[model samples]
Target: MPHRRCSLWLVSALIVPLAAGCDDSAGHDPADDLPADAAAADRGSDVSPADAAAADSGRDGWIDGDGPDASGDPPAADAGTSSSDEDGGVDAGPTLDCGARTECAGRCVDLATDGAHCGACEAACDASEVCLEGACTAGPVEAWTVDFDFGGGESALVEDFAVDAEGNLYVVGTGRAAPYRTLPGSRAGGFVERWDTDGTLGFRQVMPHLEATGASPLGVAAGEAGRYYVIGSTVGAYPFDATHASAPEDRGYVAAYDAHHAIEWLITTDLVASRQLERHGDRLYAVMRGQEANAFPIELEGVRFTTDDGIGFDWFTIALTTAGAVRWGHGSDTDDRANGLAVLADHVVRAGYHTIATGGGLSSHRYQLDALDHDGTTLDGYDDFGVPGGSAVAEGGGVVYVAANGPDGWVLQRYIDRTLDWERALGEAVHVSDVVVDARGRAYLGGTLSGAHSFDGEHLGEEHDGWVAAFDAEGGLRWVDIVDNPAGSLWVVMKEVEVSLASGLVYYRYRVTSRDGERVVALRQPE
Candidate 1:
């Protein structure tokens, strides 16, 4: 959701086998189902993107582009198809021709905007109303879309959106429309909007200091209660490489909002514009592009919000540029730097890829994940799984699910505690960036396929479009679904998935990384 300078990590306290960090011998468990790659292949292709879209669309009730947790018994298909379904073998729902019928939840309806399913399916809202999270109540999809009026080819562009537990939807992006209104040619009228689930528009306020018309909110995570966090960069804040200015003034922003759609707190950091935001309880976590300051973070500080306001929150700093371990600070990266963190109930898992060696300059190594305290205390005995793509840590069924995307997907392992007892790889290396787990102990991953797509026009489509493979509880290979019929990046790249326990909706979002085209899909899977 935002970008920043880099550098952070602590490989180990003491050195043993020292593969990377953590105690590999303690909790490593062999993949339960099929190997990552083979698991994808072995599963037959009985399901399609339609099946996944319908039955297992969301675990909770409503689904957005943020989470992915769905379960259903689907008819058998190509073994490769099983690789894509997270629940493995079973009939999830009835397969429908996506192009013909607009799929929402699990039922197929007419696409000609109805009173039930507005955009697709039996999903029709009132006359002028659009569908938000199924139900066909009232109002538009998001606050941002209703507030801004573009007046160009399209009214506006909705880059990112997130919904809270109160059934209120929050969206931030560029443009100006009614309800989602922006000042006339105000140039920098960048804004964030929040809408109630009943289709009532809440707040539509504008943010100051955005560079141009390009800066838009990318990733978003809802916090405890109705709090919201957004991340994205300004078009030309400081302008690093000449053409704009001398010093890197182009900075990114991570802001917090209260339930009533008000800025509770915010800060500007010089992170490269990226779309990735994750909330660890009350605090928000992101992989921003900031300047590589000192070796570690001075402290884990944020804002103080009593009621839609910041009450003198401390201004702390950390220089986590590379890949090293830290107690209360950031670290340095090897070649380039990158770090990913996710929150579990009791622990916050921080992981890094292509980690370099520290000190007297030892040989360099790649890939490792570490669990740390919410206050920045590195947990003990980590190191059982080897990941390539970014990693995601989640808790369901009383077990913690740590899914990391790697080159193809050879390096992957699950854990119950610090000791990793099982570890295994699919060996194909498809590069699954993140993973999500359900209450029934199922894993769903999303990312791009390396050689899977080719760039044409502004869209990225593949011969088959990036595939989503499903793995069994023990890491057995399940089914894999080839998304999208046209093969464009439209439905291929699953940037994120939101799984809500109460709502039972699994929202999966995908779009062209090139920032072209508009595609929004919502489906409900039958329990």
Candidate 2:
């Protein structure tokens, strides 16, 4: 049935604790968490009947008590789990009206206007509350709300999501409507959806229009201030002419949106958009996947933005200088997908994932974190952050935090730009997807959690909640908020997490269905 909750507890309490005890006394170093059953069998110990049963029952029978703790191979590095894994509406429901039968943050407050419970179940409220512009009230809104149902079956995978200084939630996902499930009036869109920071359903459009009628908006990036940008391949339409999009095919596409969710302009080039999008300074970069015609590595490009009247059109391509036109092409890594990139202290930090040997017994793909010049040319410094694959990085003070899925499970690790500082394992269960750090140095990690970690960052806080988990700069976990079950799978988790400094709230663009309806709960740092 559903991964037995009893089994989950056993792994945590009985198993993990006993394993830790064995490590201390035996003085034997693990090649990183060799299953208890396997380790014990190697020791040739006497096993009880029930113990053998447990081992057999857990982890595909790879359990010490049951079997050799099944699915081994250094914990299947969670890769592109296409397989795995709400919101603000248009003012259609009643005003401040909620059912009292629902269970909330320890009380039966009205789901509507109850300062404590805004939308639905168990979403508790803090003490002194205030109402902002969302579907709920304020008081440091923990509002993470999203509605994901682009018409069923066809799922929208948000590669990256972020919010502007104005509190607008920008989500970048790949799906279709024409053949799949498009919006009501749209032909069938392969576009991005932009929601107001206050959870309003105002802005939605085809991310990047195509001229050849072939491509769609591929990659997207957002800045800390008021700018939003996306990259793709398409000889798309210009702001002046909707009729212009029916021409030819464009490669490296770049589109700019202002704080009001209005498109400024659209520019098309020649970059096969493979990964997502990233931004450092004023420079916007999009990394294309696949090899080039010359049999070289992948391609990379960046474009600069300038405003033309209210609509931002006309900008220079950063990959080359427009003055006299010089071919100062960008660089790429051995890996196909663009792992991540960041700008710190005038030094541009770029990272990618590569598969290599580690400790002989275990060899897998980890991350490559590097520092380059502002022009995206000069390589300053970099290293393998011990994570099996390249990941998103954030630099503050002297430490840089990376969110990655490595040899272990999920990790929100910190490095000193040069040295590997620390990596506190977030989920003792699965892998982590994205990591972000705030101006206050508070670190937030988004991934699938088997259970919640203690707010004090000690042990597994609760057996509930699998998806959203947050940790501090010191690697201490703050909270783990459960989203919902997918179909019949309870372990189904949330992926991308976008935090807003303006409201001190976190927004996860992934979709989760509750009882009566779908919701995106904005979980706050508990007070």
| Number of the top TM-score candidate | 2
TM-score for each of the candidates: 0.51, 0.58
Tens-digit lDDT string for candidate 2 (1-527): 01112101000121232222221110011111221211111111011111011111122221112222221111211111000001122233344222433334333343543334445554444433332321333233333334343123333334445666655666544332222121223222234444454343323333211222333444566654445776544333222123223224344455665544334555444434544455655555444433243233223233332211222121112332211122233443434332455555565565566556579599666566645555655554545464554366766554677777665655666776555678676445544556666666667665554565443343343333445555666776555544444453444344456665554456653333322112234433332
Give the alpha carbon lDDT tens digit for every residue of 1-527 in model 1: 10101101000011111112211110001112211211111011101122222333232211111222222212111111000112222334575444544555554444443335544444434442333333443221221112122112332334456656643556555432222122232233234544333233344433322223233454566666666777655444322111222123434555565554434554454444344455544445554433445122222234211111121121111212111111233332411122334555666555555445577877456655545555645567566556444555544544555665465553446667666645555334244545666566555555555544422122233432444444446764333333443422232455544333333333444444333323323322211
Worst 10 residues of 2 by lDDT: 76-85
Report the Cα lDDT for residue 104, model 2. Answer: 41
Which candidate leads in lDDT?
Answer: 2
Off by over 4 Å in 2: 1-144, 154-159, 174-186, 207-212, 223-227, 235-249, 258-265, 294-329, 336-339, 355-364, 378-384, 396-399, 404-409, 450-465, 484-487, 511-521
RMSD to truth, every model:
18.8, 19.8
